[model samples]
Target chain A: MIIRMAFTEFKLYLREPASVAATLGLPLLIVVSFGLLINPGTDTSSLVTYFPGMAIAFSLAILSLNLLPTILANYREKGILRRLSTTPVPPASLLLAQVAVSFAVALAMTLIVVVVGHFVIGFTVPAQLGGFLLAFVLGTLSLFTVGLVIAAIAPSGRAATGIGMLVFFLNMFAGGVFTPRETLPDFLNRIGDFLPLGATLTAMRDAWSGSFPQPLHLLVMATITVVFGLAAAGLFRWE
Target chain B: MAIIEVTNLHKRYRDHVAVHDVSLTVQRGEIFGILGPNGAGKTTTVECVEGLRAPDGGTVRVLGKDPRADRTHLRTKIGVQLQESQLPDRLRVGEALQLYSTFYPDPADWRRLLSDWGLEAKRDTPFGKLSGGQKQRLFIALALIGNPEIAVLDELTTGLDPQARRDTWQLVEEIRERGVTVLLVTHFMAEAERLCDRIAVIDAGRVVAVDTPSGLVSRVDAEQTVRFRPSAPLAEHLLTDLPEVSSVRRVGGQLVVSGTGNLLHAVTSVLARHQVVAADLRVEQADLDDAFVALTGRKLEESK
Candidate 1:
C-alpha cells in the first residue's frame, strides 16, 4: 500500500519543478560548479571530502524541512487526508510515503555528490563507510521526524511552506552549511553543536574524512530521533 | 433492523454548540434525508454516524456496532461522502477509484462503477480539472466503490446545476435499488420531497420534525390560497363569516381567500348561493416550502 502511494507521490513530486530543483538539482549544481572552480584539488582530506557529505546533508534539509512538511500540510489543508481517513486503510500511510520518497531522493543526492566529487574533484571515498551509513540513517530519521512535527503544527500547506522555509534557512545557517567556519560566531556555533542537523553533519564529515564518527554526535542524533519522532506521532491529525 | 441509530447526539466546539440533542434512525433499504439550513448540525450528525467524530454526549450505532468503537469494522460495511472533503489536485479519477477499491475486502469493479456514474470519459481527468457536477459524481462513485451496505452522503448535490442535480438524484436511486441504505443530508426541499423516503427537518441544532415528506407537509397546517375575480359585487360578510376561512383580502380586483381544509368548498358554495361566478380561479396547495416555513419560521431558500 505504501509503495503504491509512494509511486503516486513520486509522480506528483516529479511534476513539481520547484521541489525537484531545490532538493535534487541544487546539490548537484553546487558540486559540479564548485568542483570545476576549484579543479582537481589533491587535498581530499580538506573541503573536498566533507563537501560530498555536506551536499547530502543539504538534500536532507530540503527534503525533511521544506518539501515533506509542505506537502503533508497541504494534504491536510486540502482535505486529502480527511478523504483517506474514510477508507479502511489508515492515513498514516501517507507519512510512510513521504519518508520513503524523501530517503530515496536523499540517497540519490548523496550518490551524485560522492560520484561527482570522486571522479571530477579527486576526492576519495569515506574510509569508515559503516560509520557514514549509520550517520546517514540516524540523520534521516531525526530530520524527517522534525519535519513531521512541522507538518502537524501548520494549519495549512501554505503556512507549512512558510514555516518550513524559515526553519530550513535557520537550520542551514546554524549548522554552518553556508557560513565559513572562522566567520561564524562562537555562540551560534555552540548552539548548532546541539542541533540534529549540525550534529549529524559533523558526524558524517568525521566519517567521510577517513575516521569513525564522534560518539557524542551519534548520541545527539539518536536522542533527537527518539524525542521529535515520538512528539510528531503523538501530535499528528488527519484533518 | 435499523442500519443506523443515533440517540441524543450532542457535539460542541469550544463554547459553540454544533449539535444539540439530535437523534434519528435509518432503517435498512431506506433513503433518509436530513433537511436543515446551513450550520444546523446536519453534517455533525452524519459525521458521528460515520465514526469521523466521537459524539460528546450520545451513542451512534451502525449495523449493531458503535461507530467510534467499531470504526475499523464499520469502515468495510459503510461508505461516506463528506461535505467538504477533497482529493489531491493531481489525483486522476481512475486512480482515485482504483485506490479506494483496495480498501474493502469485497469491492466493486472500478471500470463498471466509472461507467455507471457516467465518468468513463473522465477517467484520466485530474480532480481539480473536473467541473462541480463531475466532482460530485466522482464523490458518489468513490463512496460506492466499497460496495457498502450503508452509504452516508452529506450534501451530495449542493452547488450543482438543476440538470446535474436531477442526474445525480437518478444515480442515488440506482444506489438504493442495490439495497444500500443511505443517510442523506441536504437543504433543498424539492430534493427532499422528491428523493427522501422520510425526512428529519433540523433547525438550530435540533430536530423539529421527522416524518415522510408528505407527512411533514401535512403537519404544517399552513393555508392554501384560493384566488379569483368575483363576477358580481356581493355582500362581503357572506365570505368573511365562513368558519373555514382565515382571511379575505382584495388584491387588485381579485378576491383571495387564504385558509385550510375545505375553504374552497365553503367559498364556492357561498358564491353559488349569491349567484356570483368565480372567474379565473386558481387554488394553490401548500407545498414543502410552505411547510418548512411553518415549522422553522423561515424559508429554506432564505436560509442559504
Candidate 2:
C-alpha cells in the first residue's frame, strides 16, 4: 500500500514544477553559488572542501523542512486527508507516503549535488565509499523523521511554509552547512553535537573528508530518528 | 435492512452542542433527506455515519457495522461527498475517478460514468480548472464510483444555478434507480420535497420532525395564498367583512390573501363583487418551505 501511494505521490510531485524547483533546483543553485564564492585559489579549496556538508544541509533542509510541509499542507488545504480518512486506506499510509517521497527527493538531490560538484566544479569524491554510504543513509533517516514531525503538527499550508522556513534556516546554520562546528562559539559547539541536524552533518562531513566520526554520533542520530518517527506517527492527523 | 441506523447521536464542539440526540434511519434503495441550515449539525451527523467523524455519544451503524469501530468495512460499503472536500489540484477528472474506483472491489464502469456526467471533454483537465458545475458533477461521479450500497451527499446543489441544480437532481434520481440508498443533506426545502422519499427536518442539531415531505407540510396548517395584481391598488376595506379570509396584505402593487380551504374561490368571488379584474392572479400553495419555517420558528437563512 505504501509503495502504491508513493508511486502515485511521486507522479503527482513531478507534475508540480514549483515543487521540483524547490527540491532540485534550489540545491543546485546553492552548490554553484558556494563553489564560486569560495575562490579555488584558497589554500584548502574552501568551497570544494565543504561539498559533503553542503549536501547534507541541502537535502535535510529541502526534504525535512521544505518538501514535507508543502505536501502535507496541500493535503490539509485540499481536504485530501479528510477524504482519505473515510476510505479503507490505512491512515499510516499517508505518513509512509510522505517519508518515501522525501527520501526519494533527498537521494536524488544528493546524487545531483555530487555529480555537479565533482564533474562541473572539479570537486573530489569521498575516498571511502562504505563510510559515505553509511553516513548518507543515517542522514537521510534523520531528515526524513524531522520532516514527518513538522507535517504531523502543521495546521495549514501557509503555517507549514512559515514554520518550515524558520526550522530550515536555523538548521542550515547550526548544522555546519557554511562553516565547520570547530569554528563556532564554545557554548553552541557544546550543544551542537546533540542536535539532530548537527549530528547528521558531522557524520556526513567525516565520511566526505575520509575520516570517520565517533560511533556515538551515528547512534545519536539514529536514536533521534527513531523517537521522532514514532512521535510523528502518533501525532499524525488525517485532516 | 436499513443501510444506516443513527440512534441518539450527539456531538458537541467545546461548549456548543453541534448535534443533539439526533436519530434517523435510511433504508435500502431510499433517498433520505436531512434538511437543516448551516451549523445545524447536518454535516456532522452525516460525517459520523460515514465514519469521517466520531460522535461524542450514541451508536451509528452503517450496514450493521459500527462506523467508528468497523470503519474499514463500513467505508468500503458507503460513499461520502462533503461540500468542501476536494482532490489535489493536479489530479485530472479521469484520474480522480480511477483512484477512487480502486478502493472498492466492484466499481462501476469509468467510461460510462464520465459520459453520463458529461465529463468526457474534461477528463484530461486538472481538477482545479473545472467549473463549479463541472466539479460538482465530477464529485457525484466519484462518490458513485464504488457502486456503494449507500452514498452520502452533503449540500448536493448548494452553489449551482437552477439548470445545473436540476441536472444534479436528475443524476441523483438515476443513482436511486440503480438500487443504492442515498442520504442527502441540504438546507433547501425545495430539494428535499423534490427528491426525498422521506425527510427528517433538523433544527439546531436535533431532529424536530420526520415524515414524507407532504406529511411535514401538512403539519403547519399553512394556508394556500391567492395573489393578484389589481388594476388599482386593493383597498383594505374589501377584506374586512370576509370571515373565511385569515389575513390580507398588499405587497408590491399586488394583494396577497391567505386563507384555508376553497380560499381561491372565495377570494375570486370577493374580488369580482368588488369589481376587481386582476391582471395576474396566481395561487401560492403552502410548500415544504412553509413547514420548515413553522417547525423551526426561523427561516433557514436567518438561522444560518
Candidate 3:
C-alpha cells in the first residue's frame, strides 16, 4: 500500500511543472552549461570537474527545500494527510513515501548531471565510488530531514513554498552554488563547511577527487539526519 | 441489537459546549437521524461516534468496541461523509475511489459503485470540476466503496438540488435494503419524517426527543392559533369562554386565540354572533414544526 501510494504521488508529480523545473530542469541546465561554456582559467579546476559537485548539490537544495516541503505541506493543508490517517496504512507511511519520492528524484537528477558530465564533456567519474555513494546518501538524508521539519511547521501551501524558497536561497549561497569555496574568505569558507549544502558539496567533491570526506562533514550530515528526522516526525500534524 | 451506543457524551470546545450530555442508540439495519438546527451539535456527536473526535465526559461504542480505543478496527467497518469534506483538486473521480478502496480489506468494486451512484459517466472528471450534485454523488459512492457495515452521513444534502436530494434519499433506502445501518444527520423535518425510522431531535447540544416521525408529530401540542384584528371592540371573554378556546390574548388591537380542536371554527362563530367583524384572520396548524418550537422554546428559524 505504501509503495502504491508513493507511485501514485510520483504520477501526480509529473503533472506539476514547477516541481519538474526545480528538480530536473535547474540541475541539468547547470551541468550542461558549465560543462560546455565556461573555461576553468588556470591551475584551480576545470568547469567539467568542479560543476558536477555543484550541480548535484544544487539538485539537493531544490529537492529538499523546494520540492519536498511544498508538496508535503500542501498535502497537509488539503487534508490528504488527515484522510490517510483513518486508513490501516499509518500516516508515517505516507510521509515516508513522500520522502522516498523526493530522494529518488534528487538522486535521478544527480545521476543525470553525473552522466552528462561524464560522457558529454570528457568529465571523469568520481574516483571513490563507494565514498561518493555514502556521501550522497547521507547528505540526502540530512537535507531531506530538514525539509520534513519545514513541512511539519508550515501552516499552508503558500507559506510552505515561501519558507522553502527562503531556506533554499540561504543554503545555496552557503553551499557555494554561486561562488567557489576556494575563492571565499577564510571565515566564510569555514562557515560554508558547517552548513548543509556546503557540507554536502565539500564531502561529495572530496569523494569525487579520490578520498573520503572530512570526518566533521560526515558527522554534521549524520547529526542533522537523526535530529531533524526525529523532530519532524514528532512535530508533524496530520491535519 | 444496537450497533452504536453513546452514553452521556459531553464535548466542549474551549468555553463553548458543543455536545451536552447526548445519548442515543442506533439499531442495526435502520436509518437513524440526528435532526437539529445548525450548530446544534449533531455533527459533534456523530464525529465522536466516528472516532474522529473524543468525548470529554462519556464513552461511545461502535459495533461493541470503544470508538476511541478501537478506532483502527472501527474505521474499516464504518463509512463517514463529513460536512466539509473535500478531495485533492486534481484527483480524478476514478482515482480517488481506487485509492480509498485500497484501504479496506475487501472493498466493493468501485466500478459498480460508481454506476450505482450515477457517476459512471464522470469517472474521468476531476473533483474540483464536478458540479455540486456530482460531487455529492461521488462522495456517497466513496463512502460505500468499502462496503461498510454502517455509514455516517452528516448533512448529506445541505447543498444539493431538489432532484439530487430526492435521488440521494432513494439511494439511502437502497443502501439500507442491503442491510447497512445508516446514521443520517439533517435539519430538514420533511426529510426526517420521510426517511428516518427513528429520529433524535437535538437542541442546544441536547437530545430533546427521540421517537418515530409520527410519534414526534403526535407529541406536538395540538393548539391552533388564530390571529386577527377585530373590526369592533368586544369583550375578550366572548372568545375565551368557548369550549375549544385554550386561551385568548389581545396585543396592539390584534386578538390572538389559541386552542385545540376547531379553535378557528369556534372563534369565528362567536365573532359572527356578537357581530364583531374580524380583519385579516389567519389560521395555521401547529404540528411538528410547533413541536420543535415547544421543545426548544424558539422558532426553528430563530434557532438557526
Best by TM-score: 1
Best by lDDT: 1
Reference-based lDDT, residue A108, model 3: 88
Docking class of 2: medium
DockQ per candidate: 0.61, 0.58, 0.48
Model 1, residue A76: C-alpha shift (Å): 1.4
Ranking by lDDT: 1, 3, 2
CAPRI-style grade of the A/B interface in model 3: acceptable
Residue pairs in candidate 3 whose N, alpha carbon or C atoms collide under 3 angstroms: none
Compared with the true structure, what per-residue lDDT tens digits does model 1 show for residues B144-203?
A: 999899988989898899999998899889889999998899998888999999999999
Q: Which candidate leads the pack in DockQ?
A: 1
Local lDDT at B214 for model 1: 91
Off by over 4 Å in 1: A180-183, B230-246, B264-280, B301-304
Residue B150 shift from truth in candidate 1, angstroms: 1.1
Question: Which of candidates 1 and 2 is the stronger one according to DockQ?
Answer: 1
The C-alpha local distance difference test score for the whole of candidate 1 amounts to 0.86
TM-score of each: 0.93, 0.89, 0.86
Candidate 3, residues A1-239, lDDT tens digits: the string is 77777887787778678878867898788877876676433324633446878888887888889888888888888767765665555667878888888878888887888787777765678888888998899999999998999999999878888998998887777667777777678887777777788888888888888888889899988998999999998998877
